[model samples]
Target: MNYQAPLRDMRFVWHEMFDVTGHCQHLGLDLDRDTLDGILEEAGRFTAEVIAPLNRNSDEQGCQLLGTEVSTPDGFREAYRQYVDNGWASMTGPMAYGGQGLPQMASACVHEMLMAASLSFRIYSGLTEGAVLAVHRHGSEALRQTWLGKMVSGEWTGTMCLTEPQAGTDLALLRTRAQPQADGSYLITGNKIFISGGEQDLTDNTIHLVLARLPDAPAGVKGISLFLVPKILTDGRRNELSCGALEHKMGIKGASTCVMNFDGAQGWLVGEPNQGLSCMFTMMNDARFQVGLQGLGIAEAAFQGGLAYARERLQSRSLTGAVAPDKVADPIIVHPDVRRMLLTQKSLTEGCRMLGAYTARQLDLEHGAPDPEDRRAAMRRAALLIPIVKGFFTDVGQEVASLGVQLYGGHGYIREWGMEQLMRDSRITQLYEGTNGIQALDLVRRKLMGDGGAELHALVEELSQHVEAAGHQPRLQEMAGAVSQRLEEWRALGKTIIEACQRDPQEIGAVSVDFLAYSAYVLLAGLWLQAAVRAGETLTDGTGESAFYQAKLQTADFYWRRVLPRASAHREALLGGANCLMAMPASDFSC
Candidate 1:
């Protein structure tokens, strides 16, 4: 099934659940409820109509590369043109640089739609936002003057060039070099692999943010520096960089993942020397979170497709009895097992949307909160949530996609129905934007234990208040109780691990993924309780949206009673310690 944007669900998360307009107002933005609603509505319409139609075709044709030039799949170029023409690229950018300067949450809402519609097409415009933000936050005035406007307007797309022939995640092994020259520009020579959108036909030029080292710099990651290398110079002369090859991958085939070779390319520096990792991180963080949005979008699309198929496909009668006696057999949706798969997809999809939107609100707070301390607190909160958003959301997204395939049986295994494409596309999100394992390590070792668990403590404190209050309410008591227990379990488990890590350095690594998963369940359960409460409010207040609110409450009930139990298993695994894993001798293991 072709994708359809879940507008009502999105509105529930953005407006009803969080009151995002109020959040925007507090961020000091002029965006009101009407304007935000219109923006989301338009974004929904655009993606459903223009972008979704091209997804299957794009995957089949993939990207084209000839003589160092890469062209997108057939309809992608036109769709991208419409995307830029609609001012989508600059909606979330800084107004001082020719953008609308809307709240980040507004952009998150739109981005979720774009990502859901066509992730492959979205790849072309996606990196531009992060690149624009990195330059705005850290680049010099002249650099900003030259690049910001065009990029914000979607005239030039961007790429992050950190991967090389030898270096993957280990930047210390990077060998790309930049030679300083008299004109104040450096000559960059290097080859980067797995560079998405390294070269594309959609934009006028491609701006690459490359990581390289100068002659006098130090060793390892400390010596690395960030550079801006454009494909075409201001006067329209082509630079020395070219797309050496395009990777033929399993999925997201529509995106041009390339091997780019830079031969003494014209370049300028971004941020200080020997601080490239730090600077690129600004771009990376934006990318990481957006990748999580990618996961959310893909999951939503997969669920929609799967749910639709389940309702129509007839099979054996229900175990209890035939729901459709007139037919030879009932729809597969009548089966309890089928209901299980669909509910799993639904609960996870809805929970992740809340998770994505919740994190976006913190980001809005980080950028716009009036008080300095409030902004810092929001930053810490966002930092803690980022890894969960990146890691856990993508993990569940893949699970949902796989279930979508399962729902269709043999039909899902093939390319025709498009379910397999969803599965293939969803696979990449967990691997890229720093693998989910890396995300877990960052969550546990860095965000959780790094600050002595301060960030997570703040998160627990905030979520606790709502959960504890809900426990006293009549209808919310059971859901609240389940979530409240998990919240404490998470806090205690974290405390135990932090104390153990002081004695054993590798202690954190052993259970980091498990801990991250555990934390994610707790966080999701907390958000479900919040949503359930709001749905109860709507029902009590008689909004006349009883069916919608009831469905939401039922999903929340499923999450708490069913999904949240996964946290207990993770906690047990976390407490199992590092010994069993570490005891295996390196030399003894053989396949």
Candidate 2:
């Protein structure tokens, strides 16, 4: 099945639900509705025509390593060139650096479409943006002048080098060493593993943001510092870094995941000394949200493919009656189980799209708002939501993709169908950018308890206000009420968990996953309610296409009735406490 960008839904969320034009005005940007619409349309055309067709072929061919150079599959390089030529790589970068300076919302929509087209292909540009943001926020003037413009223009690419052979999640265990040279630069010597786009031939140079230790520094994570290590030097000599090997993986075969060996590589420090993790968080936070978008994109593609197959694939007659009487058998869509699967995918995908867009708008407000109070509030909300977006979206993404495969039955098992490929590609999103488990812990421990639940309480109040404003409308009254009720329950659950954590610290770890999932369901309910209200208003006015508005209402109802109940299961799990989970000892299983 062909991939199509969900432009109508995206436009509705941007214009109707979020008031993105108002955001543009707040930021002093000259982005009108027409321009935004045109951008979305052109982006849709580019991804569908140029990028989507390369997905399967790139996966089949993968990447080849010849000595120190890594070559992408056929069409990959040209497609990237087209992407850069179209200025997509710099869509949301700083305008002073040859970028379009668009808001995160616009960039978010474009990214969703591109990721749906090919996650492997999108990785190259996404990493570059992350690196650009880091330098823009923390790099020295000389560093910015030397590298930021080229990176923003896609003349070069970037990578985040954090992992080592001994340290995967624990940065305190890192062994990479950075020795100071006579000049301002340092000699970075260590082996970094699992670096995405680490050795690709997509750009003239690859700038690595690495974390390493100084000789006289303190022990553990405190001693680590950030550095800029280029693949090639400014003096026209190759750096000491090389691709030691490429890891063979189950998914995203087209994306090169490399083991990089930096042997006395020339580097420059970023930010203050012994504060590398803090600087890295600037990029990591952005990356977490983007990974969440990746999940939404994959889920959307899977849903479209499954829905199309269900409408076309003939099966046994409907239980009630034959919907397609002229055919040999009724379409599988007539079956209740198939409808359940399709609706589940639809509910999750649409809800995720709205949530992702909302989060993107929050990011814009956090960065662009003139008032200090507004920026702080936006920052808190963004922090509270990022983990949920990352953890729940990816978990549900895997579920949706698996259902897509199930919808195809035997055909999904074969490589020709493409469903399995999506599933494989989506699985890694949950593992990388901090594992979903780590995200859950961060949500409950760092964001929630770290701030004494103030951010979460603020979010609950905001959702309550939205529900109250829309409560009078007939079509939205039920959803509004449901959301309000869920918000109260979420607050109560938060209080209970906080009280439990005060008694036993392990309680936080035991229930974090369930708490994160529960939070996501409630949050998505509010977003869906917002979408339903806007869609209902359009229908009441009798403007635009009726079918599109109707689908919005139906999907919202499906989410409220079918998907929202999952929150109860998560609530029960969260309240189950830590005893059962900690009951088993370390060495008792084998016997």
Candidate 3:
């Protein structure tokens, strides 16, 4: 399984759609063409040669547990060593803390390649980033000094410990308790479930950023505090608690998902006593985007696999003339249906890649841009897109992976083909890191409603400008038109959902998921139009790879033609409100 990344697509997004050079100029960063090219080349090489090979082996071996210790698959420790040796783990951290200090756009490009090559293997390393960012942003100076350097270097690992068995999605019902110790430390006693990288032996120590309620704290997410509980105490060589058990899961089998027990564990507080929930949410937002990338990565891999298979696998004669008459059967590539699946995967994968990088670029603008107004606008845009980044990318991940399986027919389900693995691995991306449904609710209930929809109106209006600018390109024009139409529909549907919520607060529980899908479709469609116009420009230049640029153009067309149409029904479901959802009673769920 040799993996050649879509380098051409990445370059297109970086140079054309995202205006990376302009962004770098704005940031006072010296990222010339040669520098950017060298970075992408190195990242793609590392992903294909180093990270990808471990996927199959990791899936087969899974994680090993002995007593209180958990070890990752066969080559993980060595591979992780190489990953750290190359400074890949430090890309997003502060230069003062021994990090590479690369732009987030560069990091996003590298991440998509790494994840596409080996999502399961990358999971172990990815957790360290989000957790480190949380600590760097919110931790005390002493805490930052103690942990940031080592974690950034991958000498140690980190975990975000939220989600108890009973308190998933709803933090108000959490039961974990943190009792303060006289020594300024705390004693944590709680059970954490679905904790990724929780108790892995891939590093010297695993730091758990646990959210627990203090003994004298308030109730319902107010009292939740973030604690830095290391597997080993300060001395860093003793086990304080135990890995209760490894979760037997549906996907990303190589990454250890653990049910952990923190029984009177010695822990130091990461932030203010009662500010843990807020602190953890900062990490969650970062993790949410990364998890969305998990979907994008797996989907890219599946798309590549499907494309290769379609080119070579001879299944039937085409309805049209024989493209490969020499072969016994026509290559699957000749068939319209096969092309549909391939185009769907390619378009979505490319669009999502650009969207992810666009989001990353916005993050960079928010963080590094000189103008305060520009920073504020970029931050707002990033906030608006986060839900789509988290919800839309992951949903398409499952859809694209399933399409990969479909392309393989019966062979896809078998272990050898690896299509099923793609589907299985991507399934959890939508489930965890604040489920897609929760993401939708956040977008509509929180982000859109802010300042009485001023931000929403601004974003939609901004996207409308992009659409208007896309008038010359037919594909872009169509995508722009469709998305603009959907936005209006979404606004109307949003008002209906809001009205329903006013009547019955539980209306959210009914319509959140479908509403999320609808919102995601609109956002993705807008992104597709943006990329389509960029691709059209590249095609006009005829400078480099015309075929690749043309492919992007055609895929964008396919998205508008085939994919965005689904938004109509999804919008209808949202407009239907809680009636269909609430009309059914709990009794109807009985078997």
Candidate 4:
């Protein structure tokens, strides 16, 4: 089954939730309504016609591994060429670096389309953009002059190498060594694993932002430094690096996740010594949202595929007179249970899309807004939403993708249907870019508790104002109230946990993930409520946009009715205390 782009839903989010035209005006961008519409139309066409066709083939053909060389599946190189030619890569880069200088919100539209069409192909470009941002912010002029232009044009690619086999989540444990040389270059030697697009034939050279340790660096995370190790050494010219081997993974088989062996590889240091963590962190928050969108994209793909199949596939007749009495049976969608499943997928996908895009817009405001106070406020709001976008989206993504497979029955499990592949590709989103578990812990421990829950309180209070304003619209009022109530519960619960953690350090970890998940549900619901208000107004007019707006409002209701209610379980788990987690004895179940 082929997945179609949900351009209508995307447009609704852009116009109703984000108000793209007004936002562009705020940014000093002079785009009119027609221009924004044209951009989305073109993006939809490119993804559906150009990128979607390559997804299955890339999965089937997979990446090729030959000795120390790796080749991506056919058409990837050409697709990338077309992508850069279309100026998509430059959309979010700096204007000084040959970029289009578009806001990140506009870039989110392109990102959603490409991600929904083909994640593996887009991963290469996504990583390069992230790496370029880091370099542009911190690299020396000579470094920027030499590489930024081509990277912005997609002539070369980039990767972030921070994870090693033993140092998966703990960056401090990394053993990759970077020894400084007399010429200001360093020699990096270590094995970096799970490096996506690390070694591929799509580009002329790959630039790696590597995290390694200097000889006299301090211990733990503060000691790590970042280096720029290109696959080709250019002393102002030369190519000198070898691919080690590509990892065989469950999905995204087309993306070459390679184990790179750098043996005295020529490298230039980035940022100051022992400050690499801060340097590489320039892109972490944004990268986390991208991974979250991966989950959203895959979930949307699965939901669309399942909805299409359910509307047509016939199985058993209805208890009442069949709507399809002429046929042997009624459509599977007639069943209440099946309707529930489809609604769940639809609710989660559409809702998560709003959450991700709104978060993107917040990031845009944080960076591009004229007012310093507004920028700081936007940054704080973004901090509050990032974990939700990452954790809640991934959790729902897995559930929705799995439900899509279930909807297809046996056919879904089969490779030809591609349902199973969607599940596989989405699973990693939960694990990497800081696992959902880690994200949750960060929320409860760092973001929420470090300031004595001051940020959390401020966010809740800000949303409360919106809830108060929404009282006139019954649907919006109820949704906002539900979200507000949950936030209150979460706030009280967070306070209790934070106070308990002061007495027992281990208590924090045990309840962190559950607390994070619960908070995310409430956060997404807040965003959904905000969108529903506008969507409700548009649909009330009974115009062409009415159907689209009505659907958005209904999806918001679906989330409240089905998904938001699940937070009760998480709240229960969190308040249950950390006993079960801490009770497991070290020798109890030794393998």
Clash number for each model: 0, 0, 0, 1
Worst 10 residues of 2 by lDDT: 466-475
Off by over 4 Å in 1: none
Sequence-dependent TM-score of model 4: 0.96
- Model 2 over residues 333-405: C-alpha lDDT tens digits? 9899999999999989988988998899889889998898899889988998899999988998899999999
Model 3: per-residue Cα lDDT over 472-511, one tens digit each: 7764665677777877876677667777776887776667
> How much is the lDDT of residue 483 in candidate 2?
88
Better of 1 and 3 by lDDT: 1
Q: Which ten residues in a row have the lowest lDDT in candidate 1?
A: 464-473
lDDT of 3: 0.83
What is the per-residue lDDT of model 4 for residues 511-564, given as tens digits with 9 covering 90 to 100?
888888887777767777777777766666665566667777787888887889
lDDT (CA) per prediction: 0.89, 0.91, 0.83, 0.84
What TM-score number comes out for model 2?
A: 0.99
Which residue pairs in candidate 2 have backbone atoms (N, alpha carbon, C) closer than 3 angstroms, thus clashing?
none
Candidate 4 overall lDDT versus native: 0.84
lDDT of 1 by residue, 349-453 (tens): 889989888898888889789999989988999999999999987888799989999999999999888988988998899988799989988887888888988
For each candidate, give its TM-score against the true structure.
Answer: 0.99, 0.99, 0.96, 0.96
Candidate 3, poorest ten consecutive residues by summed lDDT: 447-456
